[model samples]
Target: MRFLLLILLFCFQSIQLSAQTNNYSISFDNAVHHEAVISATFKDISTDTLTLRMSRTSPGRYALHEFAKNVYNFTAFDSKGNSLKITRENPYEWKVSGHDGQVNIKYTLFANRGDGTYSQIDETHAHLNIPATFMYAPTLNERPIDVNFSIREDLGWKVATQLPHVKGNTYSAPNLYYFMDSPTELSNHKVREINIDGQTVKFALHDPGTEDEADTYFEKVKKVVIAEKEVFGALPKFDYGLYTFLACYIPNASGDGMEHRNSTILTSTRTLANGGMEGNIGTVSHEFFHSWNVERIRPKTLEPFNFEEANMSGELWFAEGFTSYYTNLILCRVGLISPEKYVEGLTGTFNYVWNSPARQFFNPIEMSYQAPFVDAATSVDPVNRENTFISYYSYGSVLGLALDLSLREKGLNLDDYMKHVWKTYGKTEKPYTIENLNQSLNQYAGEEFGHNFFNNYIHKSDMPKYNELFSSVGIVLSQDDNAAYFGAAVSITDDLNGKIQSNTKIGSPAYKAGLDKDDVITSINGKPFPNGIQFEAFVKKFKPNDMLSVTYLSDGQEKNTEVILESDPSYAISLQEKNGDKLSKKVLKERKDWLKIE
Candidate 1:
């Protein structure tokens, strides 16, 4: 009787402890009207210093933005309203000292930039983009978060957020923790709801058009979501929301969509012309798929995100690149995109990957780790550019395709890989390591596939066997004939007067002419080539092995040499094509069967 009583007491204590450890609440007030106010309440159960943080950077963007600078009128108080001193530790972090078990921090955030935390002041309506304005305790990863928002907009203007509304225009959620830390796009956005697989999905557009267009776009998007869910076996969550904001006259604005637990904010060009729907659909698919990869199954480095500094990871390729790879596949599988279009996209990516000089220098995995710094730098020193760079997107997509093919070749398939990854990593509460990735792949392959594959391709500078992979899939990867190229690859810089200021890469012809880096090419073959276009035009007329009298200013001395133009193998991918024989009849039949098209 004594032992049973002791057991009951211990079980009751454990339940109470669990409840105490997970307590947290957030309340948002728009009573102030000018700025969005957020109040977070939590119990401090640890000895470590309590810190509040706003993300320095989002997944889609490679640049770091100090979001905490936007915060204003920050004040922390004890349960009895006594002011507690809060210190600004960094641009994106704040530290509170002398805080015991329970505390509440209140702050007013100015949302004015349409890009991040933004608000409109005109008479029409008021808008707020949430992620930029709301601040949270960075260390409370596993705790439940509740938000109460009071929004102010035009009398008739409706507000939309991924959070379930407890009252009119006011939203609340049991937990804002985990990847659910999504920004709210609160505006007079046009709302359209559709049901797919018995789940309701909402689409909110900044400048939505006619009812017919909305219906058409929503139907297509619904099909896409269904296709992805079918492949993954189930949707990540029951409710999902998409918020799209369109911008006019910006050069593919540097921003893209960001994934949250139940919502995504997609920044895109306003013009819906020239197949804009296709681009929008593709973006939607990519961001939506993140609900599976980065949101649930995350890298160890990403779990306790360093909002003040760069969180480096070697697996962003898998997080982002694999997402890129699967987007097209899902689109094709759903009949949203034709096989020819898919092949064309893959061909373009291949050409881009093969032509870049960075491929000769850095492997994909290395590029993944150094992305935060290298990706942010605008000016690339010519010498370093040759050795330490590659596009993370391109490298990742290529590997994604290669891995998919390898899986299919082994009869395991991408579907199997996705399930294995989800079961081992996605379902876990903790982020995964490189060892976890290797173990998952090895389990599916029943061999040391990860070791052999990464050692040769990922960790090394070895390129993928594109020819073999594409052929196996019945897709002919072909190069276009009219692609432009210089007989020798040359990186050029021009002066203010449009004259050749420097030749960063001295091709065989330029090298033979005694031209070096920083050499000023005054003229090509006697005629003055004043600019890049003119220089390129002059080079185009010359055939391989053709000799020309080249004149340039080298070290303030006029030099001339008989230079022979050599063919550039760097342009090989442009010249290469998947021959008709490469796409065997068997593979073509499989493509027909999979696509349900001839």
Candidate 2:
């Protein structure tokens, strides 16, 4: 028995030593045309046929984006440089056979979009989102991976990525998941770094702006990193003791922010010298907060994220929403935005979530499940999203606000609760479920408190008493009682008529009056509408409870209706002082503690 055990151990060690690494190389010979030549070499193959596929989904995204459509000129070869047989398995996959224990495949990749989920290779830079640029074998997913980038030195391009560097222009990943999560940017960019709590955080700015602008913007990035670190009580134990921010703030880049295990991609068309200095920092705050929230304090449903299909999770409310709540709040805490600006900015999202009829259809959990349909998804069919769906981002953000203020009423705060969660799950790198979140809250703030909060908000669509909650912190939630409401968005047409641009809200006056998208309003109050003015100004002439004879064209048919105007349902939140209300000592203390004001 002892001899047999030793022989088996020796055989396992031999197999491990013979395991192969998937090697890839990318070059931009036709970067001017937004094309990249990529090749992958697989060695020591155990199967007679190997399957290669491009990922249909990307990290931090919930939708399927057919990456295979961008690949062309695909060819396979054996070790002797002889051509091999290739078979089409599907639109996303190809099968190669008759390889002599090795296969080398080359393909042309056409990438022009510059965002978090897509790859862009142009004369300015190569912003490569890994999954959108590479093809991998599902069978050898456990094997180590290596990539070498042949950068264009004439363009002064340098590589910025989260993948651990093995040598010059080459990087390695432990497995397929990590490689896909690593997006690379090769540009003539400036880099700024800081060491926090013994871990290094870097910001690589790819922009056409001055060095001073880059320096000013990187200061905000540093402050965001530090503020978010304080929320989780510490930075995540980054692989290789490093975290990177790959930022592309240029004229052609699309605005997006995506979080990964060790880094994030920040792309925007707004340059730092122009509006982006303040405009882009909000995204910076949001994505860095995700380093602790979704990346490490992960959701079990998103564990081992699927590359071939949309990855959905019911916990995006807490994962994405809570981070969103802190997105602006952290900026306020870090002095990027004033406390008044932060509080006042709440009005837009507050009205969006509070007044939305979508709450009648789905709870926060169910809203989170709608991610695949709405998270950067594309479709031509018209759907009633305005009436039936609320973004999980807004829904969760408001809930996080409610929960925070509710906890403060009980002499606790959300920061400590988040710290407890981070220690239990994020620091331990443990994937969690919704019940686990409830359990964690129960452990921190008693069972009854947790149960009621989750039951009322998470499991059901019941709204919290936000009016009283805001009052506790000396914030005023007020609405205009006399403002007339028009629920459908209207645009002025070229022929000087009001065109309804979207579906009216379910319970609004416009909906009750049968007004809908594409209806051209010809006259109001039995008089032809005067041209050369905005639609909003035209609507402002009427007051609440006023009756009007509205005539419009629906399906090119003239129709007239009696519409009774109702008061606007929108609400605004503001500081007590801003509203001429004195803050009591108790309310003042609560407000100070909540906003971390001096």
What is the lDDT of every predicted structure here? Answer: 0.60, 0.92
Tens digits of per-residue lDDT for model 2, 467-567: 99999998898888888887778887888778999888999888999999999999987777667777666667889988879899999999998778888
Please give the distance, in angstroms, between residue 488's alpha carbon in candidate 2 and its true position after superposition: 1.2
Query: Largest TM-score belongs to which candidate?
Result: 2
Top lDDT prediction, candidate number: 2
Q: Write the per-residue lDDT of candidate 1 for residues 1-598, one digit (tens) a residue.
A: 9999999999998776545443323222442344556677767547435777776665444456566766787887766778777787567777876666566787766554443223322222334444455666656665654455444443344555666655654455554343335455544556677665556667776543555665677777778777777657876644433322222112232345666656666655542443456667877788788778777778786766554566678777777778888888888878888776776667667656665556666677667776677654344555445334666777788788888777766665766687788877776645887667777777888657878777777777577777776666675554434433343333344442222333434233554456565555565568764454555665666666777766766667877766666664332221112442445577766555444465
Q: After superposition, how far is residue 355 of candidate 2 from its true place, in Å?
A: 0.9
Q: What TM-score would you give candidate 1 relative to the actual structure?
A: 0.75
**lDDT score, candidate 2, position 108:** 100
Model 1 RMSD, rounded to 1 decimal: 6.1
The TM-score, computed over Cα atoms with residue i paired to residue i, of candidate 2 is: 0.97
User: Candidate 2 regions off by >4 Å?
Assistant: 1-19
RMSD of each: 6.1, 2.5
**Cα lDDT for residue 413, model 2?**
93
How does each model score on TM-score?
0.75, 0.97
